[model samples]
Each structure stands twice: as C-alpha cells, then as structure tokens.
Target: MRSNASDCDVLIVGAGIAGISMAAHLQDKCANLSFMMVERRAQPGGTWDLFRYPGVRSDSDMQTLGFAFEPWDDDQSIAPGGSILEYLRGVIHKRGIADHIRTSTTVISADWQGDQACWLVSVEGPDGPEKVRARWLYMSTGYYDYDHPYDAQITGLESFAGTLVHPQFWPENLDYADKRVVVIGSGATAVTLVPAMAEQAGHVTMLQRTPTWMSVGPSRDRLARVLRRILPRKLAYWLVRQRNIRLFDFLYHAARRNPHMAAEKLSEGVRKELGDLYSPEDFTPPYNPWEQRLCLVPDSDLFKSIRQGKASIVTAKIDTVQTDGIALEGGEVLPADIIVTATGLKLSLGGHIKVSIEGRPVNWGEEFFYRGCMISNVPNLTFVFGYLNASFTLRADNTAAYSCRVLNHLRTSGTQIAIARPPADGLVEGEPFPFSSGYLMRDLAQVPKSTDALPWRLNHDYLADCRDFRRNGVDDGHLQFELAPRVTDQSPVADQPEMA
Candidate 1:
C-alpha cells in the first residue's frame, strides 16, 4: 500500500524451505501480489543443498518438516539429504513459483525508505550489483553462516598428515576407502559420520569430550506406510503430518517439564539397542534431555556399527592433534588417517546483511521479538527462526500463514507501514532463546532480546503460537498501522516478469 511504486510487493531473500513456503502461501492466498525470491546458491534447496556430508539426513521427520501444501510422498520419514532436496525443488515447480526465483543472487543490504514507505534492497547478482524497491522483506536465509563454520581450534591440526574435513564444505570424491577415521565431537554430525564412514573405512572412531543422549528410530514410518495404502494420498499426508507435529511437540514439552523421566526414558532406548556394549560413561550425558537435542541414530546404525566392531566411541578431552592422530588428556593417542571435525555451525542473524533505516543502522540485538514473528519497532520485515525442538518447516508454514494475514490486512486497510511497537509498560527481560546448544549459546548476543510479557517472548512452542495467531488475529494493538489516509485501487507494485 505504498504511495510510491515498488519493483515488487514482497521480496523474499532466500529460496530455501522457508522462502518457498512463503511463496506458496502468497501464490495460494494473494495470487495478485507481486513477489520475487533471491537465492545466493545456484540451487533452490538451502541446507539440503549446502550439506553433502556422508550420511547426511534430517534429525526430524519429513512428515512435519515438509510444507503443509505439499505432501511428502516418500516412505522414509527420516529421509536422506538428496530426497529432501528433491522434495524442496518439487514444491516450487509444482506450485509454479520456480519462475519467481532468481538463483545465484545474494542480498547484500536492505535499507528502509521512510519517505517512500518501501525497502531499497541491494542485491549482487551474477552480472553486477543492483537495487530494487519492495514493500516488504522476508528473510529466510537460515540461522547459520554459509561461507564459514565455527572454528574447532584443533591444536596441531595443520601438522597432521591426514585428510582434514569439515562437514560444511564437503569435498567431492575425496575417497576415504579403508582409511582410519577419527570424527571429533559428539553432536549429530559425528553420530552420522561415524556409522556412515564405518561402512567402507577400515575403522571409524567417534571422539567426544562428553557423551550425548542418543535415541533409536526407524528411517521409514511403518504407520505412515499403512495409512498411505488405505487412505488417499493427501489425506494420509495430513493425518501423518498432524500426528508427527503433536508427537514432537508433546515430547519436547514433556522433556522440559520432566527432564528426569525423559532422560531415563531416552537412555533406556540406547541401552536396549547397545545391550552388552552400553556403558554409562559412554552414553550418559551430564545435561538433561532436550538441554541439547538427543542425537538420533536411524535403525540403530551407530550402535550396530559399534556392535559389529566397525566403529567405536572414545570419551576423553582432546589434548592435541598429533602427527598420526589425536592425543587425549589422559595420554592416550587415537590413530587416524582422516579427521572429520563435526564441530557445529556458526549462527548468523539477518544473513549478516547490513540493515539500515534510511541513514541510521538498526541494532537487532536491542529489539524485542514481537509475537515471535516481527522484531520490535521494525517495519515490514519478517524473519523465520525455526523451533529448536521440533521440525523447522512447522514454523516456516506457520510463519507464511501469519505473513499472508499481515499482507492481506495491509491491502484491505490501505495502510502504508506496519511495525511492531516496543512494549509500553515496563516488562522484565526474559531468555532470548532457551536452547542450550553450543552454536546458539556462542552467538546469543547477536539475536533480538525477549521479555516476560505475552507477544514479547521468543516462543519455541509452535502449537501455542499457531493457536494464538489464529484466535487473536493481527490487530493486537502492538502491531501499529500507519498512513491510512485514502481509499484507492492503485497497487504500488506492478506484476513481476518471471523472476528476471
């Protein structure tokens, strides 16, 4: 509803799951709206495309992780990375929004123009840098840094005469056949790599400072397979999706509310899988369940590998990176021909884009997370920060629905600017995001602040958020609308040309 013309009505900044979901929502609900999606990578799939490491897969099930509009037709709920990438690509093509996306284009900066009531976005395409005006900006650029990962700081890493690899930048065809591999860190990546590399490697060892809680799950959903046979495809998908969403939401809340029972239940699963191989020092984590996500081992692959004598786990502090392998603090050396550093990702907010309001820079850390959607006092910008406990696309789908609501409101009400006003009454500060993962904890100061008040907290409960959004609606008095002077049929953004 900007008085001034814009290049597009809504400009999506990434072509990932989140961005594609927004596009689908717009395509279905607001068909006439002009929108464009820009992806830095040549491909549409974000994390799925970026991460190509061994045994790469989703920890969360594809049932709820996949978009609401699209039914994940695969039998394997805990799918491989390739399957996920294909599903994501299919969503855009099936929805006929492939033409709305521009690949190999990066959003460098976005500045809000108050006078024109639009965002002047700077993008670096293949040719050169260009600026475009948009009524709104949606950032789906993900939580982690694309180019770099968090440094593991492995001492004498360079001195070792071995193939050193990080999961982020997985090299092509660098064969490790029959090679002795030592994968550092006990996170999900290490759990995945140990078993995967164990298939062909002489032996694979998972080295960890502290043990992580592990759970056993099947890759294929047995009930989903049964339902698919009896019910229609779409209906089956919906039922399966809902079942998974509720199950995960329940488990996450249960873990937090009753950490003791949850921890015991989770450990029991591991003990059952490993049996004689189970050791308290190797499987028991110091932290409570959901403190850090319990790593999933589909079909007990990690445990199977250990039982089969193909892989093993060593719990000790890494003392140094020796010439042949890694040295432990207890003077034990682990021989390795290859070292895989599965040390987590680096969290980056707003895709590290320099955001400004006309000439003034915006400090995102100072802002409060308004209704877990928009940042406080920020106008026409929505960022998708997914759940730590549940599937990511659950939030992506919900965010798109909420975004459409805002867009519809703006068009119908004839408003130019819609911003989340900072809390008026004195509200005490709350936790920003309650996740205890090292990656998130390291960069806690970079994200927005949270408050004790309702609609001010950075919520993790998707079920609560979805219900609240549907029941309460957009006009909560916190999100203020501006420049509602006239009733005119003029649309600021003309229809976009097929993503050129």
Candidate 2:
C-alpha cells in the first residue's frame, strides 16, 4: 500500500523558520548534496500560518525574529503576523528553496535501519504513504505541537449553545462582532486575544486560573525609525537587535541574580500604569520574572483596550461551563456568547516522536546534553534550540554554524559517523532546565536538564554560544565519530550508533 519516495542526502521535516534556515545553511556548505524539506501545511511559516487571531504579532522584535540572511525591511520593529509570513515566503523564494519543499507532505515516522545505517522515513502525501531513505534526518518540527489546543474538559462544554473556540483552532467564519466573549487562561495567547477580540466583540472577559506577570511596552518603536533614517539599513538592524538583546539580557540576568531588584523595577512600571486600579499582591507571580516568559503587551495595547472598557481581566479558576456562560469556582456566573480558550500550547520536544536506536527507545529525559546540540548516545543528529531571552534565530544560527563545522570536520577526517556519548558516570550535574510547565515537565526526568548543558542555563546568551559553537568545537569531550577510509567510486559508509 506504500509507494517508494525519492531518496536524498538529507531530509528535513517542517517548513517553518527552523527547517528553512537549516536547508539554507546546508545548501551554503554542501552544494552537491541533495535535500528535501517536507511541511504538513500547504505553505511555509509554521506558527505564523497557524495563528490568525487578531492583534497577532511577534513578542520579539522583527530584527531578532527574522532570518539572518534576509533583513526585514519595515518601519515597525514589532511586526504583525501578516508581515512576518510575507517575509518568510519572500525568504523561501529569494533563496530558491521553494522547489525543494514538498507541501502537504507529513512525515509519519522515522525509523533507523541498522542494516543500512540510514533512516527509513515513512511519509503521508496526497498520493499515499511513501518511504524515503536518507543518510541524515533533520527535524525542525519545533519544540511545540502544531495548533493542538489544550482544552480543559469542562462539565458543560458539550452542552454550551454558544460557539466555543480555541485560539489555535479559530473558525474562519465565526463572527465575534457584538458578541460577549469569555477568553479562558492568562498566558500570552489569552493576553493577546483579549485585546484583539475586544475590538470586534461587544465585550471580552479574560478569565485566568492563575496569575501571570504581564509587562507592557511600546508596540512600535519611534527610535527604530529615527535610527533607520540616520544609519544604514543593515547597521540600524544590527543596532536594534543588539540593543534589545542586551536589554533583555540585563533584565533576565538581574531577575535571576537579584530577584528583589528585578521585582522592584517591575513593580515601579506596573504602579505607574495601573495606579490604584491594580494590586501588587494579586498580580505579582510567586516566581521570578522570566521564570516563565513575561507576557509582552506591545505599546500598552492590551491596557488601552482595558482602559477603553472593551476588556476586563478576572483572576479566578473556572468551575465549569454552563449553557450560555461560565461558572467560576467561587460561585460566580459570567455570561458569554462565545468562549475562547487561550490556554497554553502542548509542548512536544522534537515533535514528541519516539526516538529509538536499534530496537531500544532513547530516553531523552534520562540523557545528558552535550553542548546543547547532541544528546549523549544520539549520533548524527543535532537539534537547534533557541535561547529563552534573545531571538530564537540567534541560537539557531549558532547551531547551523556549528553543524557546518562538524560536517566539515567529518569530511576532512574521512569519518562516516559522528556521535556525542555521555560520560560513564550517568549523572550530569548542572542548573535546572529553564522551562517549567506543560509536556516539558512530564518528560523532564528523561531529558537532559539545563544545568548539565553549557551555555544553556535557561537565559539567552548568544555571545557565549557563538564563541563556544563557532569558535571552538564541542568542548565537553562528547563528540564521537566512526571513521572509514574513503573508497574510489563508492558511497560513504554508514556506521550505526550502538543502542543501550
């Protein structure tokens, strides 16, 4: 029932920013090698294409979020969703990478064939199931799942007469205009949706099960424009990127090192904005800022929406859903024509695919991380994880650069397989992984903790990774490879890693 798929030197899953960037980088280094990128969606731009809620914009500035090869040419630093998607599409076209992408092709499973020492990838396409063999498999499926909403099973959800929509699964034809909307959850999605839906809806009530640290800053930076005019385009871009990087770095580090100081600085800003309307006790999180990402309300737009009486924030746990409203745990009833569940995303590290070597599954939770790139015993696979502070692209760029170096090294050494094995001690002592909740927590026990990984201490520090990954090779004595002498008129030998 399966068709044979075309073989390639490398097969990349996902056509999002990470996948595209990886392809672009690979093309630059190895021109002769063939690669194919498969995206489940009809188009590129993974999250950008999926999220269509109003007021959707990058939490990070475009300068940092954008690809390294292409500079985002726009007046606004904080770009809207449409612009970001356009930029990605343009990057795909300009790089001539569009031809290699297979849209609507979903990778079902990747199984390592020990006999062939290659990956036998099963993909589902329009035609049917197809199998493709590749020497290397690059997964850019992202750390989060694709628009799979985490809807809490409310008692009366099925009986509710009104339209119930999760932001991730927004119905295209659903009209919110003049309708009373209740937005559940208080994370970034809810914060962004409340103001956006408020614009069209008659009223929006943001219901939260818990408190989140919300910080408001200007959506559009006037200084960005002034600098753009004064300085060259590239220089301006670099300046803005660096400025934001340093600012975030300082704030994140200050919060980690001196929680009291960070809290004081954050409190001053909140007090000025809300005056007596907000209480510090209720709003402030028990954890330090950046313990989780501080939700950014661009240009105080969320606040403006609230000030205009279009939106209201209610901090309480929901008891259940009613026929036409929501009942709070404290016996309060709030009526709504639509319920928008803006709850958090379901985290799936490496797309939650079970990775196995031979017949044994690799326990990512129990493994030690090597240079934040390779997991111990995981050979020939390198994952690109972005920084928590700066733009994710920065860390991805470093990962690409490191990959180039590693590949080049292998080529020069006449090595067929390379792997990073953890030391025999089995215990990796370091800082806790930066992320605190969702699926990440569930699999934390098996995955490498941040403390064990260098330059991956939760905070985004690009310069450190730049120097480590680019300037120096894998430093922890972890990178291991198998070598086979080059043969005349013969393909490179495939060496499979030994599974535990």
Candidate 3:
C-alpha cells in the first residue's frame, strides 16, 4: 500500500445490480477483503433509478435477472421498474451492502501504479475531487453512456412547439394529460411509453420508420409459482432460474435456426392479442426474430391500448419536424402536442473513465476479453460483463464468482498483479455482441475484439460460459501473476507517476 494514499482491496464502480451483486459475492467469498462501491448518480438503483418513464419494466424475467445469491421471490416475473428498484434496495439492506456504497460520486479515471501495485482512482464527489488506491478495480459500470444518450439527429428538431422529452431523462412532472403524444422510435422505451401514456393522453401515436418484433406473455410465471408452492425457497428459485435460461436459449436458437417459422409464431401472437386491429404492415418487422432485442409486452398492454383506440401506430418515414406536428414523407402531417424521443442509448465502456496502465492508455478494441471478465494485458482489473440475449444477472453472477476465484488465487499465491496474456493472433475482429441494433453498430469498434475460442472469447452462451468457468480453474496457464515492484524510497513521487 502507498504511504500517501488510502488503500482498499477492491474498488467497484457503479452501484447497480451488477455492482451490488459483486459486492455481495465478495463479502460472502472474500470476507477479509475490503471493498467499496461508487455510484455516479445520487441514488443506487442504476437503470431503475435513472429511467422513470411510465410503464418502465424489465424486458427479462426476474427469475433470471435477479441475483442468485439474493433471489427475487415475486410472483410477477416481469416486474415494474419501481418493484425492481425496491428489490435491489432490499438486497442491499439485507446483505449489509448499503454501508459500502458512496453515492453522487463519479469515477473520472483509474491509473495503475506499478511501483505500489495499486490503482490510483480519481473520483469527483460532492465535496470535490479526491484520489484513492485499490489493489483490484472491478468495473460494473454498464455499457451505456450516462451523461449523453445517443443523439438522434432529426431534421428541424428545434422547430418543435411543445415539450420534447427523451425517455433516458424523463421530466419530473410534465403534464401530458389530454395532449396528443407522438413517440418516435419503436424500441422498448417507445413500446412501454405508448400504452402507459395512452391511458392519460388525448391520443398516443407510435411513429416509426421500421417496425420491431414484439412478444406478449403473462405478467406472472405460472410454473415458478407452482414450484414455489411445492418446493423450498432456494430450490424453487434454482429450478425456475434454470428453466427460464433453457427456455430463453431455446427460443433464441430456434429463432436463428428457423427465422421464418419463428416470425410466423410471433405474428400469430400479435394476431391473437389484437385480433382485427393488428395491421400486418405496422406490426410485422422486416428482419427475423431476435435479430434485435424483441420487445416484451406483459399481458398485451400495448395491444389492449390499441384495441381500445387509445393508441395507434404510424409506420412511415418522417419528412421533417414541423412546429405544429411531424410531416411524413408522403405529405401526411401527424398532430402532436408532445414529442417523446425514445431513440436509443450511447455506448461508453468503463463508465467513460480514462483507464491507463502506469500512464499508458488502453485501446480496448485492440485487446481481447479474458473470459469476459478482464481485459487482456490489463492487470488487477476485472469487469462484470453481462449477456445480450439472456438475462444480464446470469452472466454477472458467473463473472462475480470467477473474479472471486481470481482474488482467492492471488491471495494464496502471494501475487500482487494478475494479467491475462493473449496468444498469438488473439485479436480477431468480431462483434462483441451479435445484435445489430443501431446503437450497438455505431460503437462496435470502441469495445474489445471478440476471440474465436474460450478464455478469450466473450461468448453469449450463458450455459457454456457457466460450464467453462466452473471446469476451467484459475490455473489455466494463460494468466501471468507477478509480485509488484518494491518501492524502497517510500516517496509519494516514486509511488504515483504522471503519464509520459
């Protein structure tokens, strides 16, 4: 530890579900280690806290999304944002993880101090800027950029006469009641907002250039409820979680294997819900199912809204944003008092933090992922990487467990640093996630290169990843562990050096 710096065994950034899960795992597995979680926002619930748009809910099931350590026992598998936030808060208090969280603190940068074998993390808090040292840096910061969402460049956007809101930064109390609302974009946010705002607004219209695949399912999991009634709590959770994983995997794989068949089934579902109201042109997507994220509408809320004539869908290209309304390419004007931009989010890796190895900045695109946990050649830093197709927490739990294993291995081996050394021709130019969403496509090159094989590849298969991490122990010979350089001078200058 450096003489001038306060030291912690682990420094976790982002107090979201991932960060909280990691903290819980660390406490359970590495009892002797000291750790702290820093949240950029004033509150702790990450996504749940930030996104306050009406009808905000989880796209994934709670059985799979919830941490295995602290299982969600709710009957509703598809939970509302407030419910999920409450669940996270409950987990924090129950696990005594609240004390470790430092809110309203932004981690600006993390620089590796080679001499002292620690990360000098620069963070901006309410008081001011300060620096702290950590032996290992665990990043749970999500992929999206918090400060800036994806800027959807719409022509004549400044000509809007009414309130323009982005779902990312929803206004506190803007009266949309009796106002004709037009939500642009057919993504998850738009799907959620349409039905929610339709109940109150005069009329709600979903304006999209392209249609997205939507799936409808029951709000509560019947199987999970039955199992919970018959089996033990932990056993019920485990069983339901595994079943959901297999079901999700099967559906995703089936959709890819037989896209036409899968598309028909999805279309049938819409027809069942909307009946005569379902328009083939408006409801059907151009691409195959699971090509992009499939929007989930619990209990056909969106369809119900449409059937009741509260909401409507307009599948057309926007010609321009007029002061009174949006003009379509075919000269159709849609009157809207409020325009909601439910476009997408911008990708930012490592929470937009400037990460450097002893003053040398890391090029993530050039590096390979070490079992989807750590970056290759980057020492003493692990990440909580989640899955794209499946529930994020499934992989987050696995990554947390793997990180703990690495921590234990280091402690047992008396090593100060652990770096993953990639093999020759390791950097293969592949997609980080196979999804072709516009937001993901825009910044694909900014993230790490995908490898072709295990230990380096960030595979989307949760089951395969789980098996590999379990079977392949820490001593795989790929990781190089070394004792840090001894600082004999004990001077602050010798410990922390500026980038050359």
Give the best candidate by lDDT: 3
Query: Compared with the true structure, what per-residue lDDT tens digits does model 2 show for residues 1-500?
Result: 46445887678788887888888888888666678899989988888898888777887888788876667778777788899999889989988999999999888777766555466778888888888877667777777667465646667888788988887877787889999999888788888888888888999998877777777787676767878889988787777777877787777778888977877777777777766666765468777777777788777777777778898878777788898999988999989999987777765667656567765777766665666665666666767666766677777766665666666666566554567765576554666556455545654564555554464333346766666665556433567766423332355433422111
Find the 10 residues in a row with the least total lDDT in model 2: 491-500
Model 3 Cα lDDT, one tens digit per residue, 345-455: 898888889999889998887788889888899998988767878888887888888888888888877667789997765555555777788888999888887767787
Q: Which lDDT tens digits does candidate 1 get at residues 67-120?
A: 888888899999999999999988887888898898998888899887677789
TM-score of each: 0.95, 0.91, 0.95
Model 3 TM-score, 2 decimals: 0.95
Per the 3 Å backbone cut-off, how many clashing residue pairs does candidate 1 have?
Answer: 0
List per-candidate RMSD values in Å.
3.6, 3.7, 3.7
Task: Rate residue 382 of model 1 by lDDT.
Answer: 91
Candidate 3 C-alpha error for residue 306, in Å: 0.6
